[model samples]
Target: MNIVHILKKYPVVILLLLLTACEEDGDKIYLSGLEASEFILTETDILLSKENASKIVLSAAWKNNTLVVSNPDMGAPDVFTAYLQISTQEDFSSNVIETEGTGESKAYTGAELNAIARNLGLVPDVATPVYFRLRGSIGANMESAYSGVKTVYISPYLIDMTVGFILDKDKQQTGLTLASPDADGIYTGFVGATSWYNFFMEEGDGKIWGNLAADGSAFLASSEEGSWNFWYPEPGGCYYTEVNTVRKRWSAIYLPALEVSGDITGEMTFDRPNTRWYYVFNAASAGTATIRFSGQGDEYNYETGDGAPAAGKVTIAFAQENGQLVLTGAAGTISVQVPAAGECTLILDLSDPKNWTCEVTSGSEEPEPVAPEVYVIGIDDGITGGGWNFDNKLYLYNEDNLAYAGVLNVHSLWGYQIGTEKDNWGDVYTQAGGDAYSGTLEFKGQNNLAAPAPGVYLFDVSLKNLTYALTAVGDHVYVNGLDDKWEFNQTLAATSVPGVYSGSITVSGASSYGFKIYLVQNNWNMLFGGSDGKLTYGGADIPDSNSWSAGTYTITVDLVNRTYTIQ
Candidate 1:
């Protein structure tokens, strides 16, 4: 065969014969000239950063002669495996990192190089020299050959300190975590506690951090393992907490409630994620008055800004002092103009702790009041009284409740109308056509309200919610505390009025004339007494004051209006 064809047919065998022709041991195999060759590096100096973590930072390559097997007659073997060893020591005596592959060159990314550098005890952001060497191994039983060491200067960056777990004083995880999106070492989140509690923060690297001072004077933190835990001084509520590892400082703002006091007064709802407190302010009349923001055990007075209480939106200006959002001026001195008779929304935004602001914008106004005269008009259907007459009149017995109730004998397929005026068809209320007896009430619709079934129902209408309901009426109620007996003995019969019950009871043996009303016999779940001189569900006692005198009295219980009276 020609030289080219012979070399191609048994290239490994010819190369081994030419390199190790004088060797005699049949099983011996080795790589020649590996120790004498230099290990080449693409970059002798590199600066590593988290921003370029995935980018290729360094590359290493070395040349080694082909494997030489003593017996040319043996089967030819595949390419040898190359290993890249990295170490901080010049002699590579300890802490060596080894990586293997079937190639002559190896490349590393910034993150991989940074990790290796950190593993070698190199300080972050500091440039240090590391040693690299290449080795080649032919087979499992064969000896390996290594190349000379190459030094490279590398600067590593700190890993992400963004995620940390909030642990209780017992060092147990609380399932609450804080994150620094920017990875700037500042973590923020809200925590709720039932009482005074102490907590600690454990970083993603399993390093626990706590307050530097044992007493937690200013909420400063330390990385020491034995540091004291951060604590809440006040009792039981929600708080906005922030921790800055860079500055070793921390702060917790107690936010039990946010309220607006003075001319524009109302409670504000908390928008936790946005760190905002907002409430709709209604202007009864146009005037100028000094208004203040209160809650968090302090008052926030107005400083300087044109965004005062006006007809449109106005943003109030604020500043930060000592890491807390504070009002510029003294309390009760910041006078603002109130908008004309209209509604306005007031907002206090502390989303940015350094810059706090208040904004006033247009808001919804209170709705018009509904007239108290509401009557049920429909065909009698034999069970009800007058035919096509407004005889079943619903009464708003309780002004505070703002609902009308009355009993009506309804037919399964019958339709009804709730009218404002007696015998007036023009002023009536109808709903969307349906058999859903309990639903919203429409001022005027294409169809009348359909009855759910044929039965005596306690019909109820809520003026505030613009809704209606039809509940089956119970026949009677159980009365207790009569004649000083705790057990129920007297019963009040339900009247034609939806929830009204009347009965005559003699309180002769009772030391005090007190009683409780219950819907179910021997059941306290649906019970009622008196609260603030009105019948209340699950209230303390009848008469509220518990000072009723013994006598024979006619008792009237208005369950719908939540009121009771003894005549």
Candidate 2:
């Protein structure tokens, strides 16, 4: 009998038995004899633009395909899956978009079509032929067939190019533009702010960027509204600025030569190795002398800041008080006396903002040159496995005071020692064995220094003072009473520079404004609070009084410098 005729004679029980037998033998019922389907386009030619981004630009539809089982006695599953594929190539070889769905039709919005066209390398504002087809599948892993291809002419739109601007501290436009060629979030351009080092950056879309603190360095930036204006230590003239919206970071590089004028005048020479500026000249008459520092082609008159060099012939110091230069000592006088009218040399060091200073030396005789020596942290005994070694170098914060500071990882009972020499076992500085973190250091102590416990520590030692201190470095720094709640809810994160931490906090208008930086989070025993830009270990509230109003601020703390800034 023919297979069709035999199926007509088979009963329900026999059909069930046949299906069970197929399953037992692990046989798949292949689908065959699929009916041809057609893919139809509602609008073959369409234009996509930003104006119609949300509107449907086109529609595609296909007829439902039908299939029959290869087994004459069995029936095929009625379930079917359809796919809409659009590609630039007629054969769908590359740059193809395939979407699977259960419906017979699909609609493409202007944004959807434009994105597809862009992905397929379609030229903008120009009609391009796009191929479309329908793929239908049935059974398990069975890709039954595909409909004939349909051609569609589509014109896509371009990404909106964005422009950025440079704004002064007062938010006034500076006529400088930062371009985003790729319409990406990053913007870059050179801005000649001249005397105006403090400024802000804004995007065409209303995004704004500024410095995190009022007295923050140029390298630090923030996009948060109401933040302080971007500023450098001194007027750096024109700068190549780059604002990255995606990363929320900005940077600027000053592009100008430095020069000095007034009592001692000359073009400053750049010491690349030392990262400083230097100028040597004879003093016409040194009686309450003043100097002005300016960048090449710069209109700003930047005066000398506080600097005192001990090794110079005549040690001079300068300080910035309310944006002006001043000289003061512990008793509010020039710490280093300026020599009588004679030849002198000036050194400008701006490499480290915390250690920014301008040192001037008098007389033709320069201080005797000495071999540069560095301090390192290591074990006490040289012969021991953990003895003195040239590792873990400390930072020299004050060149005049020979003060070195840095964080060191200490082990309990490790007997640590600070070595002046790099490799030799000479000049081993230490204190009598004890768990104390602060004490006087001996030239060659009989006992090695010991920590209370194993942990990272803040090590500050001054060879000039012959004293050493070790404080356990806390992992976090918290702002307490920022919201007038007397609580620690804001935590400052450690920045790229060690010993520096920064965070944002909001302050509400209150009868009094007070806050403190807690070395230990949520604790008051070890905290910092002070007035002006200086920080005290256990000083008073930050503002010193009720001088600040309600606003959000970025607070940065420099533990090594004992200073803090809120902007």
Candidate 3:
């Protein structure tokens, strides 16, 4: 046949034969020693600043060190895909950032790195190290080994952070400034002269401050009486305060201070029912004398007139003479003289106005210090198992040295206070200084107390001196039930209410499951199980009859009641 005629008639057949041969030869080709070579970073170690971060670029060369062998009649694969991995951990267990494409090199912007660093828990002005590695893949299931890791040092740009306390939520006062965060990013402050203060955080030169909502925005105050109730921050909680750099405004995260109600001193009985009550306060010095009253109802309602007396309620008036205070009111005149210049409290017996008497005390003496027989109530933060609930009454037993002691497991950055009675905000005790580890304690108008870290502690409180000491202790509780597969972490916490522990769990399956509670998750010590609907300490496992059905329930174990209930 002629060449031109044959080519036209069998062109398709010839092409198929050539392709088939190539496929067979290509199938025989194999690559060995496939590995991604160590990356060539632009900078092995970097100290990133805000200014430099914007201008910096993270570039790395990704290379494959694999040996490709092919039949003489075949050729190597045309393209290879490469990937770069960056992480804060050496093992890349978490916080891993990846960049991949079909190229020999990869580049990341400074902004991208900054975001990654933040996710790694890196704070501004703190030097943190990050790791990087490269890998290559040719097909699904065929990937090169990771290359040697490289390190990058980075320090984020910092925004100014400030904290303050607003004494009254109803009225805006020039908030008391708090000490700046130390090297560890911890803020310290003292709160006195106010029953309860709302804490706030601000950024950017500390000029503007606002409230933070759950979604991290400015919280608007309502016009109602308790409109700002929801804005009250929780003590011992860590929150992120959002900032608007352009406007120099900060949406601060609010944290509540530990509140303690100081003791009430002097006993006064009235013989007649009168519409008003009065007390004369004498101060050692006369610098805008301020007198505080602790009784019932709203704090503002208990106060009357700047210098005039009010009928049917409690009232006090002060006039200065030679740096001393002479208080005059409907209850008559009282003189206050003390060695040191300070304020004093006068207990007025108005129940019988005709035969009323005044019991005076200096500022150094707490109105009603904790007494030996007084019931000592604990402060409940969520971590303690009370879930920030104060309804439960957990009283501390009296120990030696006029002290009441209890064991508590504290969560990191959490705060709490002590009180003499249940549901009484007028007699609470708070830390005297910002440092709870070593600080004097005061009652009623004081800041919340917090532990620097999380752990178990032995709280020793003395009502006589209005002081407290916390010593580390070792005591824990655990739950082992069908819901948890008889595992730990189903912990039962002590609530503010004494002798009761509460927790929630999800039970699976339709059948009943019996379990037991223990002092420790893995330990068998102090085992408690249901015995005829009652709790038996160090007893047997709860019988199958008491097994719970499939559902989510809150379990309350009452030691005082010697019973357990699933709700």
Instruction: Give the candidate number with the greatest TM-score.
Output: 1
With a 3 Å backbone cut-off (N, CA, C), the pairs that clash in candidate 1 are none
User: 2 or 3: which has the higher lDDT?
Assistant: 2
Best-matching candidate per lDDT: 1
Query: Candidate 2 lDDT, tens digit per residue, 1-567?
Result: 112212212122111001111132576565543434455677778887656765787887554434455667876566667778889899998888899855656888786687778778888999999999776666454544667778999988863446676676677675556767666878765454432245776654345677665331334567765788765333333444567777666655454565566655677765432445677677666555566665423221112111111111211234556543342321112222246667776776554322446667775433333224455555323323454457666655433345666555555345667777677576778784335588777778786666546555667677767777777767668877655666666789888765788987766664244677777655565566677898755445676326657777788888766778877
TM-score of each: 0.33, 0.29, 0.24
Off by over 4 Å in 2: 1-33, 63-79, 160-179, 182-567
Model 3, global lDDT: 0.46
Question: Each model's C-alpha lDDT?
Answer: 0.62, 0.60, 0.46
lDDT of 3 by residue, 306-343 (tens): 11121223223323345433333322223433333455
- Candidate 3 to truth, TM: 0.24
* Candidate 1 structure quality by residue, lDDT tens digits, 472-515: 64688878876656686688998877578899877664434357
- A best-first ranking of the candidates according to their lDDT comes to 1, 2, 3
